[model samples]
Target: MKTREYTFFGGIHPRSYKELSNKYPIEEYLPKSQVIIPLQQHIGAPCTPLVKVNDYVKVGQKIGEANGFVSAPVHSSVSGKVVAIEDRPSSSGKLVKSIVIESDGEFNYDDNIKPNEDINNLKPEEIRYIVREAGIVGMGGATFPTMVKLNPPSDKKIDIVILNGAECEPYLTADHRLMLEKPVDIVHGLLAIMKALGASKGYVGIEDNKQDAIKEIRKACKEYEGVEVAVLKTKYPQGSEKHIIKAITGREVPSGKIPAEIGVVVDNVGTAFAIAEAIKYGKPLIERVVTVTGEGIMTPKNLRVKIGTPFRELIEYCGGFKGTPGKVISGGPMMGIAQYSIDVPVIKGTSGILVLPEDMIALKNPKPCIKCARCVDACPMNLLPLFISAYSLKNDFDKCKEYHAVDCIECGSCSYVCPSKRPLVESIRLAKGEILRKGRK
Candidate 1:
């Protein structure tokens, strides 16, 4: 096994409260009553609903069709009748058009789901078509459609394909548990991705903290040529695609550009597993593994959950809240979206459900920046967050753009390390959104 540690510059080491759920094996979770599935789970254009209210749908049936090439279709996770198709609260903190289905307890599968052609024999175009039809997206929080990533534009040569197993975000271990239990699938998925992109090299980049996962993945990839395991240092935001690419391949993705521009393509290990399942079993992305954890949770666990399962069901399955919950995050504490209610359903990008106790929540009081430059030092992108935040708060977006605020990855390192407790990331996020909006105009 390779013990060498690889890393990128500038990242914080927060308390990775993984012990709350890491030890527990992934338990299968089935919703007994209902499921609320949002059509706009993936990034880019939202999907259009194909089934109407009162329509009976079978599990793995395509209920929502992709609106454009950049979008992904949505599948029904349970055999049930659509009770409602209206705007509902989503994990992204937006009221998205969602389809609510009441389970019939039958759990019937779609007839089209079956094993496909062998991976070695399938062509690159065939692989992309299967992935697109499967509705797979980046499971590590960035919900970009997987097929769009696999089909890069011509002239942008992709030499390496890296599978992100870092799971660097605190309190999230969905990817970690996946690596431990489904190493073979992950490897096969990587191989499939490499073949789809016609890339020469493939790597599974995992953090050193997950030793067992590393061992299992290394063992799985031992026979596969041009594939190896790259151990990453345990650091915050190390799982970021650009940072992981840098750590594994030493290729820096330029600002305002993607990994494809640097001759690399990165996909999360969970995405890889999904790809393997999609190509091998002809399965659509209807279910995923999610980490339901935090101090507020009574019995933290990693759960194999259906895509449309509500947060309330998962929380109740985990023994519900222990005490008064201060906050409920959809992904991880660092980069996850703070949810307004537990009524939201788990989407494609929902990696974890983090419920923070009242005591664990931080106060939002702002203080003057002491010019500490700690945020600057902690930023993995090596950008000056302090100046950008300062300008953003003042609504000076021109100044924010001058400082390259668009380059901010919104990893939350600035806000975490700020001793003054300033909302650095929050302001920078606003600036980035406005900057992009103006650029489009």
Candidate 2:
């Protein structure tokens, strides 16, 4: 079959640097002594602790209960005793309530974990229930509750589901590896999603650069009717949900509206794999594949990591730092969160752990915008980032909102293309936050 390439407007192609870790297959990394499970890994309300201090918890046991429909429950990654439940630092740079489990050395699985019936026998509500009970969320970094997405508002009509296989982020290759290694599972997951949403069509959108992954996914989808592979042009933020939807369906999601508003839904390939595991093996989301790579590390690898394993442990397993580590990001360099320490545990949204040395760190002083309009041409959202950022610096949030600052996807494209090295995305992000905050008042 001929692979047709799809692309969206206003995107910059930076150095992918994917080869640094794409060659390595995923290796399972188990925590040695303890695991710290944060209660609020998802985007919604934080989960409430179900186990107090000194309580014994088994592997895949629910340690945190979902507080609302938008939230996802948290499970223990290891069979251990709950030593403490206190506020702990999270990858989002906030102190969230967390449960600390001391490994008992014997990994015991929860009795509730057992395979379900065949996918053909399951109903739509059954699929949503399974996804919710499994505590699956958007594994592509959004971390929004997957169950909520499956159950869109009654007014919205979702006709298509897109599985994002485009690991377009620089230095991240977890989704790419998953597509090559578990293509069947990913396809099955996509089928399950389509069933849950009652969507008639399903498509797996992968980057053309990953020809191997595209071939694997296409082969897996051969038996499934209404499912096909759509190859995307290699570009930064091409894997973003909005961009992927635009590329695959040519549907534009209006500002302040979701993909569901346009009769479409998007899920990460990793999320689809999790759904397959949840329905087939009755497994909760306790582990995920994380790409541990960058120039500062002695060895780079893609590892299937437990949810609560510390970043430090993964780094140590990857041969530790090779040189002076300047920046440690919890995802890709383009949009990942920079960490002050490696003590943070791997959450569901952690697609990669990138370490950069001092030499690679570009320390350039902020210069005045040259008015080159490069940022305008590079913004995927087509918002004037230069004006939004400038107004934000002046504390004119109303002007920023008038410029549609909230529409900014925060993909860092404008910042990447800026000639003056201005923090375009950063300032726009600040303005967006302020705009939303004032709206609430």
Candidate 3:
């Protein structure tokens, strides 16, 4: 384990609130009634449904086929009958075409899911094929297709692969518990990724707050030739791809470009664990560990939940809400999306479900900017958030674009630190969307 702690510039350290559920062992959660699987869980193209209404689907069976090169497949998390194929509300608050399955109570595995050859014998192409077939995506909530990330363009020579175990978001301990319990599997997954990308070096970047996790992962990396655990300062958005890459390898990903441009590939710790399972046990990315925590939750927990399971069921399994929920976010308080309904199903990107109590929620009105330059100082991307937000509020999107509003990672650090309670990230998000839309046109 590297003793020196690494970090990037411009970030805030919010109360992690990990004590709520960090100590809990992961519990398996199975939805009894229904599992709603969405067609588009990744960043690129939405998938096309492979199974029609009333079709019998088995666990680990691919039900949604990738529609494009940048897309990922979707699989059934339960053995059941497809009762409905309709538009449903996803965690992103968008209406997505989904397949709803009624469980038959028998979790039958698909015959196509069988263990492949040893990791040492598997070729790079074979590894990529298996990852795509298993429908693995970036589990850090980005939901980018893992296969696409692993198979970067031949011109870009990837030499470093990093697994993000930072889990920097507040109220999320799923990744932490995963690191402690399945460190060996995560390391194996890293090895598989390194081989696939032909990267010479691999590192699992974990925040110093998670000492046990670092120790466990370090132990797992001991025998591996080019794998090590890099300790990071516990800061908000430390888990961001660019920041983690910078922290671990001192490589700064250029604005408007990806880590692959700098010859590096970063993946979530959960994504690695899923890859290990897919390669070793022939399991699809049908399930993941989720941290259900908040002061509003009656009983906080870290659960191994199947994809397509409704958020309501998970909350109920964790003893439901302690009081009226002021808000229920999908991932974490910072980067997570505010869910309009708990009816949303857990998707490939779902990390943590945060339930904030009504009393804990503060409804504050925005005041005039005090010009403290706090927002600019807090922005990790080195962009002026206040100016971008002001221009966005004025509908001057061109001005926003000129300020590099599209480069903002929307980490909510500025919003968190602002005394005026300004909607910094929200306005910047609007600006980014408009800028991108105009570019597309």
Candidate 4:
């Protein structure tokens, strides 16, 4: 199999535990009886309701349109009758207008849905438009609009596109399983992205833990030139664009700059496959593979779940928590949001569902930092988390920015390795929020 290697900087070594989902192949879950799709699934302005109560809708039909340039459209995930259109709680813990469809069990699709032209003959603009219309976003959990990323400004020259397959977060194997099963589609999508951006080359960055995925991608890359596969040393936050770019090209995305500004752009592995499907099979971002795992889970499998499936239903599909799961996380432990209830609907950013037993989930009280600097060493971004968190606690927005609060990816590496259990990421997130709010003012 084709193979290459690259280097990256400081990162933490977390217990993987990916074997729980990695051992089992991906399973396609049937559409549940009810689907609650939120209008604000993407990163931008939330979509306005396109339908009222009692509207009959089919699969692959648009239920909500992009509210602005930074936003994305939402589509019906299953064939059903719209029973209600009202405000519902989303995974972000915000109330959003959601279209609740009670499945008729037919799972039918719209007549307008069909494959597009061969990608080779399609224009670059068409490629970007198809991506936008397909409702594709960063499936690695960023949920940023795919078309916007693909359509970078002409002033900024992009040379290399790095496809992220690292799946660095522990207990999540969605990208890992996807790489194993859909290597060709991943390559096709990568090539399409390269064409869209007029990029000279592309590389798939996968962690060494996924040997099977590495092997599969390697085999797929042989036929294509300029497209390469690089195996990275498995590490937390390695999947970060900066880290991936550093590993692949030895280039640093300058402080407070976009990767495109550094002649590079990175896309997630799942995003790549989704692009391929959008262009080839005429599908939107209605469904995705999610890793359902944790010690409290009965069956840990990679499931191709529909978007807007309630967290409760997805958990039940995986056999739910074994005994009494005290906590449910929307993603990996390092960067996931804890849920008080499973009423939230899965969105494009929902990568993993983690359930923890009561005893294991109970967190410890934070103690004063001993100035050990373990967090600084563990931080991939090289920020002073201790100071930033301290400043945030004191509501000092200027001090927080001085410590580069915005650079924090919220990866949770610092907190995971912290001796004081200081909630470094959470505190920094609050600081970043305040800083952003002030900037808007």
* Candidate 1 displacement at residue 366 in angstroms: 1.4
**Residue-wise lDDT of candidate 2 within 1-441, one digit each (tens)?**
865799999999899899999989889888999899999999899999999899999999998999988999999999989999999898999998899999897989999999987789999999999999999999999999999999999999899999998989999999999999999999999999999999999999999899999999999999989999998999888988899999999999988889999999999999999999999999999999999999998999999988989999999999999899999999999999999989999999999999999899999788999999999999888889899999999999999999999999899999989989998889999999999999999
Instruction: Report the error of model 3 at residue 51, Å.
Output: 1.4
Candidate 4 lDDT by residue in tens digits, 348-410: 989999998888875779999988999999989989999999999998989999989998888
> Compared with the true structure, what per-residue lDDT tens digits does model 3 show for residues 1-441?
737999999999899999999999999999988999999999999999998888999999999999989999999999989999899999988999999999998999999989988889999989999999999999999999999998898899999999999999999999999999999999999999999999999999999999999999999999989999999999989999999999989989988898999999999999999999999989999999999999989999999999999999999999999989999999999999988889999998999999999998889799999999998898999999989999999999999999999899999999999999999999999999999999999
Q: Provide the clashing-pair count of each candidate structure.
A: 0, 0, 0, 0
Q: What are the TM-scores, per candidate, against the unseen true structure?
A: 0.99, 0.99, 0.99, 0.97
Off by over 4 Å in 2: none
lDDT for predicted candidate 3 compared with the true structure: 0.94
Q: lDDT score, residue 424, model 4?
A: 85
Instruction: Extract clashing residue pairs from model 1.
Output: none
Off by over 4 Å in 1: none
Q: What are the runs in model 4 whose C-alpha is more than 4 Å off?
A: 1-4
TM for candidate 3 is 0.99
Poorest 10 consecutive residues by lDDT, candidate 2: 1-10
Score candidate 2 by lDDT.
0.94
Q: How accurate locally, in lDDT, is each candidate?
A: 0.94, 0.94, 0.94, 0.88
What is the overall TM-score of model 4 with all chains considered together? Answer: 0.97
Summarize candidate 1's per-residue lDDT along 1-441 as a digit string, tens digits.
846799999999999999899998988999888999999999999999999999999999999999988999999999989999999999998899999999998999999888889999999999999999999999988989999999888989898999999999999999999999999999999999999999999999999999999999999999999999999999989999889998888888988898999889999999999999998899999999999999999999999999989999999999999899999999999998998889899999999999999998988888899999999999988899999999999999999999999999899999999999999999999999999999999
